[model samples]
Target: MQRTTISVSGMACDGCEQNVETAVETLDGVNRVEADHTADTVEVVRADDVADDDLHAAIERAGYDVSA
Candidate 1:
């Protein structure tokens, strides 16, 4: 598993946190995700094949921001 951290924004509450997490979780090879609203970031465990751009796009689509 590959451990990754992506800074995020627009998470104003726990519900928004879940929304961000769910977006990351849906990607193939994503084993786990922990979204922190206070920190405005997320930790992800995924396969080596997971693309960073895809993840960022997903988070944006879910109504959040993913740092490039």
Candidate 2:
């Protein structure tokens, strides 16, 4: 498995965190996801085949910005 921590923006509350988590968890290779609005970060544990671009896209689709 691969663990990745991504910086994110526009998460204002727990619901926003859940939104990001839910979005990323939908990815095929994603094993787990934890999003923290307070820190503006999202941590993902996923299969090695999961690409960073996919994660970023998922978060973006959830109405957030993934920081590089």
Question: Number of the top candidate by TM-score?
Answer: 2
- lDDT tens digits, residue span 1-68, model 1: 78888999889999998998888899999999999999988889899999888778889999887776
- lDDT over C-alpha atoms for residue 57 of model 2: 98
Report the Cα lDDT for candidate 1. Answer: 0.88
lDDT tens per residue, model 2, 1-68: 99899999999999999999999999998999999999999999999999999999999999999998
Cα TM-score per model: 0.93, 0.98
Candidate 2 Cα deviation (angstroms), residue 34: 0.3
Candidate 2's clash total is: 0
Q: Alpha carbon lDDT of residue 22, candidate 1?
A: 88
Give candidate 1's total backbone clashes: 0
Global fold similarity of model 1 (TM-score): 0.93
